[model samples]
Target: MKATDPSQPRERALLVQVVLGRRDRREAEDSLAELERLADSAGAATIGCITQRRDRPTPGLFVGEGKLVDIQLACREGKANVVIFDNELSAVQVNNLDLALGIKVIDRTEVILQIFARRARSAEAKVQVELAQLQYLISRIPVSRKQQRFQGGIGMRGPGESPLQLRNAPMRRRISDLKRRLDRIGKRHASVRKRRPWPLVSLVGYTNAGKSTLLNACTQAGAYVDDRLFATLDTKTRLVHVPENRKLLLTDTVGFIRHLPHGLVASFRSTLDVARESDLLLLIADAADPGIATQIDVVHETLAEIEAEAVPYMIVLNKSDAATQDQLDHLLAIHHDAVVVSARKGEGLDKLKARIVEELLAHDVHFPGENDHG
Candidate 1:
């Protein structure tokens, strides 16, 4: 058993989604739409999607046994070489699904990790993503010979560093080593922050909420703007000059999602510091998304975990062109201060910019330069 080579040609995938308990059919459909975006970002064409309603997932299979069979059939019909589960599957479940389906089965968490592995640009980001992949692989590596397709490359490569075993002691030591390296990166990040006086503004929200779009609109960043989940996995920073003589360092980091892998959070802590250190958080929400509330909660939960709740924030409801009037009214009713904008069309961006300026000026107590420090 060998770890799948990312450099190999893309594999067609069948996305399987399991809906537990009572959930709105429309909402579930929307979630699958977002999942498709994630799949596309990972260079996979989604040939089929299966949505199964169940009280709870089976212990061995995420979906019911009947639905799992259905999914297997669908994959065969679609000629999909890989099966992607919308929810995170446990180590055992992944193995079971693969055996039963006779094809590669990967969970949402693993898919996201693969995207991060591909999109990671900086050396630091590359190191961090690889470490996360290793951690995930370590957890999923099975003991039985018959139940493991994730045998190699999970914890093998380093970013021009030493290699370690994927299994036991070596993996543990590598994890420790990565943490120490990230600690050093954190110290340097802090030093850079201390030397700068410009206010930092972080764009955060659920995946596919247009954080990258807003970043580009404001700063003319030319950063890749895709209508997909986690399009901007690496944190991108650029200078923006807003109204009222205000200047800020706007940063777009990885987007949040419900049930985001814990290993990713831990591994990407260094990248998350940009958000933690920000003076203002622009919590972008998709105005047309039905699960906006749940998305907001997921972002807040992530912020709490990262200890970034202390930062003042402004809610920016984006994609106004696509939002209905009723949706607009509902959003305003819930968040009165939120500025509505279409990041793609450049609509209402000025108002959003003004509000950000207002927030920054409210905290605009300045000290002299080092030469004139009192």
Candidate 2:
């Protein structure tokens, strides 16, 4: 699909999803809601949504023919310019859908890539986003080329190469270049980490779970905080002082979400290494979000995927000021050792820091000497 024009108004999006079984109805709805948030984050206006239940997806269009007609009519009624599917669409599926609906069709992965592309600020982040985007596009090039050929656009390609080859070659080269750049940056980051004297502590949690707020409150690092999914892409590290004039390296990392793209995880492995290498991890979670338990599970699963599951860590139930007493009690019952804190209102921060000091000291974690305070 062509990139939406920034000069034009935001494209209206119609979200589509398929419920595989009766038991998956709630999960499918939640996934669709998240896709809507992703669309909003990518600057798309959601005009409507459609859901279909099927024992399994249709190989051709994903959704059945009758559902496609309903979607087409809904698109006309809502004036939707784009169709966003909750599930990952295969290249052939994307091609068929575009031919059937006569509109841009994308899946959950593309929406996430779009958000990452827009939110990437640092050079390393930009490189990582581009690499993932290139990889995703390369996977779909075959079907795209087939469609182009059917439309008689193959003859309009550059003189020496077919359309597919012309598009894929440069993207492959770009991916190689990006990898080289990222490797250099990763080496630089590793060297710096080696020279640092403080024990590293990384804050990890679901997006919009107040990890950045806690980082700012604890370290006075002034990291940007936003109440949006994947608000912080770049890792921010700061020196935080505890009791006895001891200092620790506190790092804030990009948040995890349910069903995060594997490509993104691989591409951001360098950044995520902070969590993997940390002496202690502060698993910050929102106390008020109804999906907090599931969010915690997703964070844990992501950590395990990155080989950080065995790292010593502490659970921190944040946003205590906003959570009801019953909510706090319920979470504490489940995570008995967790420290409750409100990073935004400065509630329970001292307790959290004290807990941090206790955990690090018990583990005999390293700290800079007086002369190494810088």
Candidate 3:
């Protein structure tokens, strides 16, 4: 088992996706397309993609033995050095696939973890990413003796121990250490929040929905903004001045995606506590994306999982400058009170700020103020 050299050429990747029973064909295609984008984000050149319509997944190979053979052939023809599946693979499936395909076998969860590992900058974020990666690895200890020989690759590297070291008690001890560190950090964050006098507002949205740009527009926080998926993994907070000399704490968090890994959600609980504890949620959505509706649903589902669904939130239809009139109308129809804005051009930000003030005032009127000891 050896580590891959960074100076070596990028791997050519072949993507595999399954359209399970009763799944919409269009949605399946869109999911596969997103997987391709994820592969690209992780520095892989996507040579080709293979999809199968199956009644259900095969227990051992996931895509069935016949489909697996086809994928192997596709990998050979495409000269692909790796195969990425759009669905999460069980330990058995991954082991069988690696043996049959004779290449690196990874899933959507691993792809996302790789991107998170690369994007994490803050210490807290790095800890969270490492914890999630380790948790995922613990569940993926290969059953086959030959599969255990697989070395570090794109999805295997993390902030801490190597994938090979994660097969035993050392990995458990590392996980415990990470948990304790994160618990300490979380308590510090909680104490800081307790001392803040201003009301809290958090930005929640799908990846590349312009939340970072909006944060820059509103408070000039100057967060690193990129056009790629999961570009902003660290949580950023800034003081935002509303009307009447009032100020509120605005926090930006990692974006949500369809089929987000459960391990990530659990590991990032502390970071997402900003959303759960916020006085108001500024739910941003990309108005220009055709899949905006589905994206919104995914965000809502994730928020619910974090117990943030009960919090007061407003839908923000961002990227208005790039959105068509029809698209805006459709979103407005779905979320009757959604605020429309273009965060990149700083369009409609004043109205957005005003709306924030209005929402805060409304919230204060309904709930007890921080100063009210009663």
Candidate 4:
């Protein structure tokens, strides 16, 4: 999806989700909640939501015709100008939904790419995100053109006028150009990494999991932190001084989310390489989230996808101040060695630093941060 144009009116969005088989209703609802956060991050005002239970999505429109009608009604009553789905939609499905609902229709992948595009600041990030967005559009060019971004140009003018190959030529050349640019950026990044002397430690976690906040607390990096999804798209690296004047290179990376678009992951490979090459990974998570376990698993899955799972990691359960004592105790019992800390409140950071020392030095050396001020 294209980034919302600031000059245009704010988009009011109607969210849609489908529950398959006997899947947990709560899980689907939680996913919808996260989608709402994504919509909010994209500067869209979510006005309503629609959910359906089905063994599988209908082939063409995704939802059944009756459900489609219901969605149209919701859009009218809610005054929504857009419909965002929690499910992945085929190009045909997106086109059909757009025509049926008489509004912009984008799926989860589009929404995520839109967020990444909007939040990207650095030149490398901008290239990476633009590449990903183009790659996503490449698959849909033959069918869907309502995204408005592809509304102009050759293949985007509609599929039938020119031969499919001819229509695809311009987009193909543009994609190749973006990839070449990204490759140069990647090589430069690698050269910088090779010259850095300190051992690098990377922070990885679910979106909005306080990774940025923790970076700020630990290194005073003044990294951007927001209570919204994908707030930090570019990695922020800082020199972290542990006790005894020993130094470690720490970085806060783009946070992971469930069902992260494969195109987005491939495009961000250069940025996420910091994780795969790190001396250690701090797999931080929100300790208070009711779905904490699932979120942690999602992070693990993403690390593996990026081939960062081999890097030794220590779990730092953040947001302890917001969790009940029972919740903390239960998590600690399960993730026995995990450190509990509240980045917002500066609590239990000493223990986390001590653990980092042990992990980094390959011995049981302890830091003198036995309290909040590590």
Candidate 4, residues 67-91, lDDT tens digits: the string is: 9989999999999999999999998
**Across residues 1-374, which tens digit of lDDT does each residue of candidate 1 receive?**
99888754487989988888887777788778877878888889999888888888898877887887788788878899999888778888988888898999998888889888888888788889989998998888655653333334477433543222333777788888998999899889878977777778899999889999989998889887776667777888898887646567889888898778888998889989888888889999999988899899889999998989988888999999999999999999999999999999999988888888777657763322422543
Which 10 consecutive residues of model 4 have the lowest summed lDDT?
363-372
lDDT digits (tens) for residues 1-374 of candidate 3: 78987744397999999888999888888799888888887889899998999999999899977888889889999999999999889988888888988899999999999999988888999999999999998888764554444444547544765445655678889999999999999999988987777888999999889999999999989988988899888889999887666688899999999999999998988899889989899999999998888899999999999999999999999999999999898788878989999999999988988898888778772222634644
Tell me how candidate 3 scores on lDDT: 0.88
> Any runs in candidate 2 off by more than 4 Å, and if so which?
1-9, 143-167, 370-374
Tell me the spans in candidate 1 whose CA falls farther than 4 Å from its real position.
1-9, 22-27, 143-167, 363-374
Clashing pairs counted in every model: 0, 0, 0, 0
TM-scores of all predicted structures: 0.84, 0.89, 0.88, 0.89
The TM-score of candidate 4 is 0.89
lDDT of 1: 0.84
Error of 1 at 235 (Å): 2.0
Candidate 2 lDDT over residue span 134-177, tens digit each: 88888776455465674446455445666556657878898899
Clashing pairs in 2: none
Q: Rank the candidates by lDDT, best first.
A: 3, 2, 4, 1
RMSD of 2: 6.0
Better of 1 and 4 by TM-score: 4
Cα RMSD for candidates in order = 7.2, 6.0, 7.3, 7.1
